[model samples]
Target: MTTTKALLIGQRRRLALTMVGGFAGVVALALAVAVVADLADIRTATALTDRLVPLLVFYAPAPIAAAGAYARCGGPACLTVGVVPALVFATLVVAGTVFGVPGVGGGDAPLGGVTMSFALVGLSGAFVGYCAGVTAALLADLAGFGGDGGDGGDGETDAAE
Candidate 1:
């Protein structure tokens, strides 16, 4: 293949992977939020919405990374990007708690009180789901289970090898 053709092929692959990863991340985040609500006994829509605050807050950065992952690399890289933010947030919360920092709780106090803990856990769970989804998508892509791989057919492996 010519240099330009190769470059374009690589770019297309990266974009496709990133898009898949981003979509998976979004779905995973939604499911995770639902699960959190269910686990917290939020049966009603209003109750679920109320409980979803922290989760939504935590996932604010997820889309940016997901988009980037879909644009440059495959799901594995996308997951790494998504996970780093979650880990950082978790670490900060833990560190602050250890140092007796107040109001981290999402209130007048350092830890934000009970709400803070709930939010933290929700965020963490969403992040975990996002990472899992990205990894799963990447694996599926690599295994030729899903996604377009220039094969022009669904679920058909290219026998170019």
Candidate 2:
């Protein structure tokens, strides 16, 4: 396959893994927090704004995991792989938030004031996650963690080497 096509395929796989892992993590975390908060009598579990904190927190890890997976592929395009997951997450979150909240607009427009604000918040969270994931991948590349540098774990060598 062409290089661009291969990269796209790799990115898609990374995104899928990120979504699956992220969803599982978020569910598990929500349940755990619910149990603990119930025992502790903390009302933040049901509070509207407070719940956003956990949502952002739980969502952060998925992109990091995706970046790690992408870094394993070991190429100059690792950052691109990291970014794909973040964009995917952001898009989904923004679309969901905007649609879930009902608003009456004169036109057929999708978002209203409150919903737009929520979408922005979700987008910011996704941006942070994306930056984090890309940073992790870049750091790994610099540290020679997953590059095709003949580390011998994969029993392969770069042709240029």
Candidate 3:
């Protein structure tokens, strides 16, 4: 009963499910921390520092989770798995910046700065996630987790002949 359509759907579903962890875990945590700090009127010694904390939190674990997800998939498909979630988060950040989310500390910066900062946050998250995914793939390859036993050597061998 298995069809190509069903298989593709299942694959897409798996990617979506994996991405939810990155979105819910890392991005949501960052948003919540920003909200809590705002509600509590918490301010660090420097306004810039206070504003940057959320961005830092948002980007920190994103790549790590992405790497883990890529490792789970065991191949190049992991790039999409890692990058998609990070891009999703970045899109949210850009939208929030454009719309002026209150108490996010993004509103006070100059338009250019705000745009640059949020854009960079998202872009950097994606870049880091991509790098992490590559590293994970390499490690997996080295460990012989998913391979035909060539292990990066020439295809020819005495046993094969």
Candidate 4:
């Protein structure tokens, strides 16, 4: 396959995997935290879990997707892909804070506090997920998992040549 095609595929796959894995990790972490703390009440844990799970998931793929896109498109696109999400997240957090949206981990808190917490959690999760994804994508690229290095004796390559 062409390098572009390979990169697109890799990016998409990496994004999907990163999202899934990150979400799963968040849920697992929340569960572990709840179990350890003996705060198994759904009301208490649910808010925290809800706030955290998506954030965990969102950031998980940022790096990987960026790397894959970079491998496919080169520096500018890679940088854009890597940076846009972070910018958006930051913007949202700022807006939410200015508007007094409660989004932090403390769902039991007031609306503004909760909004801030949620925003913080979501942004944090996305960042983390993105980092994980980028690292993984970079590693994969280094390992020659993505991109068209050369045809591996495929009949298509022979025909094209």
- Please tell me which predicted candidate would have the highest TM-score against the true structure: 3
Q: Candidates' TM-scores?
A: 0.30, 0.37, 0.43, 0.30
For model 4 the TM-score comes to: 0.30
What lDDT tens digits, residue by residue, belong to model 3 across residues 1-161? Answer: 11221112222334445654554465555555555666566775245446655555455445654544443432333333334434444555566667676654334546555545555655566556655655665566568773323221223222322
Note each model's CA RMSD in angstroms.
11.4, 8.8, 10.4, 9.9
Report residue 90 deviation for candidate 4 (angstroms).
Answer: 18
lDDT (Cα atoms) of all candidates against the true structure: 0.44, 0.43, 0.46, 0.45
lDDT of 2 by residue, 1-161 (tens): 22222223333344445554565455445544554555466786646435653454445444543454343432223333323333444444465456662221123444344345444554455445544555564566668773433322345333443
**Looking at candidate 2, what is the lDDT of residue 157?**
32
TM-score ranking of the models: 3, 2, 4, 1
What's the lDDT for candidate 4? 0.45
Give the true-structure RMSD of model 1.
11.4
Q: Model 2, stretches more than 4 Å misplaced?
A: 1-111, 147-161
Per-residue lDDT for 116 in model 4? 50
TM-score of 3: 0.43
Give residue 36's error in model 1 in angstroms: 27
